[model samples]
Target: MTTTPDAGLRQDRHLATEIPGPLSQALMARKDTAVARGVGTTMPVFAARAAGGVVEDVDGNVLIDLGSGIAVTTVGASAPRVVEAVEQQVREFTHTCFMVTPYEGYVAVAEQLNRLTPGTHEKRSVLFNSGAEAVENAVKIARAATGRSAVVAFDHAYHGRTNLTMALTAKAKPYKHGFGPFAPEVYRAPLSYPFRDGPDVDGGAAARRAIEVIEKQVGPENLAALVIEPIQGEGGFIVPAAGFLPALQEWCRDNGVVFIADEVQTGFARTGAMFASEHEGLVPDLLVSAKGIADGLPLAAVTGRAEIMDAAHAGGLGGTYGGNPLACAAALATIETITADGMIERAREIEALALARLERLRDADPRIGDVRGRGAMLAVELVDPATGAPDAELARSVAAAAHAQGVIVLVCGTYGNVLRFLPPLAISDAQLEDAFDVLAATFTELS
Candidate 1:
């Protein structure tokens, strides 16, 4: 018989059995029968409960979570403050459909986003249920404000799965494959991928190339918004070169094109800063946020300049469950937890610890082509040492090995050769060290 753990999940790694133990295997079998094949799971192990840095699966295996549910639980899965706020709010009311009966929680979250996001200028926010929704709304606002139809996205970018966002995204295999007849007027541009482009193509040069392409093909007059991820999420944790973002932002400013920073994965202190845009002092016309916004709640927002946001007509941007009361409450509590509990400092600490270990690994292992990312968001691109080619097989093997050993890591990138790490700030240094040790051993064993 299966048994649940204590109220507080133990913050330790304990593999009771193989990765997918009997209980999890049984559950997976059930899921395979009941669930749709399109919906995928990274790990077959089913989670019973999670807290701090560990997730206890149905088989009683307490695995160290480095992925953080795709960087959703920055404050941990069950942050006390968030739990308390959600509990209280759920008791008070679950949903009243903000568009129908406005609530204070929704307005409060909007206010917090406006005050916390980069610029000090007068701004407004519109809440949504997911990152794709936020992105779609941002595009709507940009088009409405500029009266233009064309939008531009960067290479290796992952906007979302919705029709418009799918058109905006650059990848083809999983996200856009089979789904045909995408939304129109979406264009793709090259990104400043330092690892691939080499050091000679500096940020400014990359920006100039992209700007030239935009000018020649898309044109400033037709482009409504130039949407990009400050640090691309699904397309690998690709961080643009130093001056790349600033130059592009300047270009957008001169051309009157709305610049949208999709901080869905990089925002909320995931990059050691409250927002990744802060690293380059970027004040985008629109900023999209989600994932860590409400500490695991399904909430997202598009915060932007008042003039641009006001362009959207009344009732034009909203949904039935846009800003659920419980989600809003959780967001407020999460913001407090991040600020009051020094989550930003914690993220920096994670970065220091992770980078040091990853750099050491790279120094010894030729398979590791590059070690990059900031704060808790880090990754290593695995390649064939002999030919310097992406080794997707090696990436899959490493991730499988890590899962077998009770350390949860994720693989991503356009080439599927990147092993990304996104541990929660709540994870302790000792836990991170242990996870790294496991990764090192796994690499050694594979080598």
Candidate 2:
């Protein structure tokens, strides 16, 4: 998790043994034997301490982080404002259960979300504990408001792991493997993946395919809502074709469907905008916000048109720690920090810098098939040039080399061939340059 750059990143290595040395292996052995490893893992390194964009492992290797704690730490690690806010709130109270004893901190954060989420119309918001909860609530609001059932989610979409959201999600491996008998009335359709799109893959065509599926499977008259991520997150950072979102939105409005924008991974100024949906100027009936909402505290929200949000009965949308005081405090401070510090502009600047270096890397490495993404959220897809086939092994090698050299990275995509970078916006230009050099060296070494 991250807050703000409390101190310039310091790497104090006192390695007494190999990386993830003896002590860590013992911990892992215990963990595997006793704990369920059901969650998908990205890195094997265990954190001793972390701040800014650097993570100190138990072996004492200080690896420069590129994942940003899965996009939760936007301000930085150990940010003064976030720490101060959280500390003060903790001293006052941690949780009184917003449902039992309502507090103003929760109401204040809801007010902020109501004002910030797109649209000038009167809006309302409700808080939850996770992105999945917010997404689930969005569907509930739509279903309650529209009085219908079916949901339309796109291919490669990653909503959540909950049963209902598992139905909302498209991938079947870890999400839907044993979790059979998912919530019904959920249907999947092809997404507008520009990188994979060809002469036949226009927005109209993609929309037509989805529409046709909905028509044949679940009639539009029965479809209550269509949820989408303007920029797909776990599904390979696929930015939809220019006209795709607008086209789908028009279709939804025409069919009396509640349009839900799942901005769990894209919101809070991560994609060089307040929300990726703003990239196309499309407003949805409900907007889900989380991940970076509380600067790493477990806070999430559903902000949208008041009429649709109000359809749920009084007791329908309450949770134990739904709007925990400490989380609300962190959200207020995080929102203030992002806007007050001009973090969105900083986000765009970061995207430009990363895109340039990633493009250079792509140009030099034939194995690098494509470099694409928006803002600090960017990725490089690896492939075997001989047949234009996915090269997941090459990606693994590159990431391993980078990790060995004290720089961290992540890989995504259905075939696990895309390396995505999501460093904090507060990362220094020098850090970015060093990360690029580390990547370049990793490539050269792997070659």
Candidate 3:
């Protein structure tokens, strides 16, 4: 069941010092020396503890958590059931490596994923350690099943950082720059980006456009999979136009191309449904999931038609640490909590609250070009009022100002001009409104 935040944890923001504070500053100095330059941090403060909707820094400062660690802690960071399950699993055993000895937890998690992922046809699931790994495995399974090479991705897509996924990803900076020599046979197509693509271009037209590009560029017969985020995450939480996903799925079905839904960030009730594909009544040939699967533990899965999933040879699809027992245990409990604790309804409540607050902010502020997303995952794109050009600098400034005031915020998008909000579903309404108060003030001051 869902438990309240720790008694000692206050559901309010408390600034003991400017953002990083003294302890966090000292820790930053040590981090600078010890951590790699490639690693990045959004909030400078080091978190000592986090519960419900608040994160406590080492300096005794309390900050409202709006980012949810990039949408990982949906059930909340210290979910009681998840913690208890992890502790019990640790006491029993940490790892037997599912590939080595196999375990019930692994099978149980696979069973849960199979039942939860979209589609009622005979299904199968394989667990991995991260979103990227699950995505890579999906691609592998598609290619194996279809005996095709080329894969099609879309614009404004952020799959992951691994080489194969990097090639599949569209952005060039940070995620792809200097990481060339990427995997081959990965092709790109246009997405139904409504804000920029204009309102006249409906989902059907957009799907035709994308399909035409794929046909002209990469023949459908040559394609093994067409992977996409149902509601693009990291790519600024861009929700595709209505009918767009359904049309694409239809095309994939006719063309014999495996349609893969990369629900890594949009799955597990984050989008007010078990999976975002359900929003369009679309059932993908393969669905990759992670992030909120195990609350905070590392676990991911690729669930799809049994025949397709079994395409890979007996030993072709597993890592040494894939589906570790602890992660599996945590995932089972996380799923149970989401089902029993009414987290899905909670997500819808969060969406209503966030959208109402954000709409009011957008109505008053000309810089907010658009406000779009589903359920708990939402974002506002910043743009110049007069020229309609992206205002990434203003976005950064607003995020920094919010950080100073003890509200954790995140910035994303291809142009780095989108401010995304992903509060935990377990966070109280009071805590959510308090965070927006800071956000509204930040926008007022910065704009």
Q: Against the unseen true structure, what C-alpha lDDT does each candidate score?
A: 0.94, 0.84, 0.92
What's the distance in Å from true for residue 371, model 1? 0.6
Please give the range of 10 consecutive residues that has the lowest summed lDDT in model 1. Answer: 1-10
Tens digit of per-residue lDDT, candidate 1, span 1-447:
111223567888998898899999999999999999999998989999998889999999999999999999998888888888999998899999999999999999999999999999999999999999999999999999999999999999998999999998888989999997999999989999999899899999999999999999899999999999999898989999999999999999998999999999999999999999999999999999999999899999999999999999998999999999999999999999998889999999999999999999999999999999999999999999998889889999999999998999999999999999999889988899999999999999999
Error of 3 at 195 (Å): 0.7
Best by lDDT: 1
lDDT of 3 by residue, 1-447 (tens): 447777787778898888789999999999999999999899899999998898999999999999888889989888889888999999999988888898899988988888988888999999999999999999999999999999999999999999999999999998999989999999999999999888999999999999999999999989999999999888888998998999999999998999999999999999899898998899999999999999889999999999999999999999999999889988988898889988998999999999999999999999999999999999999999998899999989999999999999999999999999999998889988889998899888875
Pick by lDDT: 2 or 3, better one: 3
Per-prediction backbone clash count:
0, 2, 0
Ranking by TM-score: 3, 1, 2
- Residue 251 accuracy (lDDT) in model 1: 94
Model 2 over residues 339-416: C-alpha lDDT tens digits? 888889988999988898988988898888888778778888888888878898998898877776777788778777
Clashing residue pairs in candidate 3, if any? none
lDDT of 3 at 134: 92
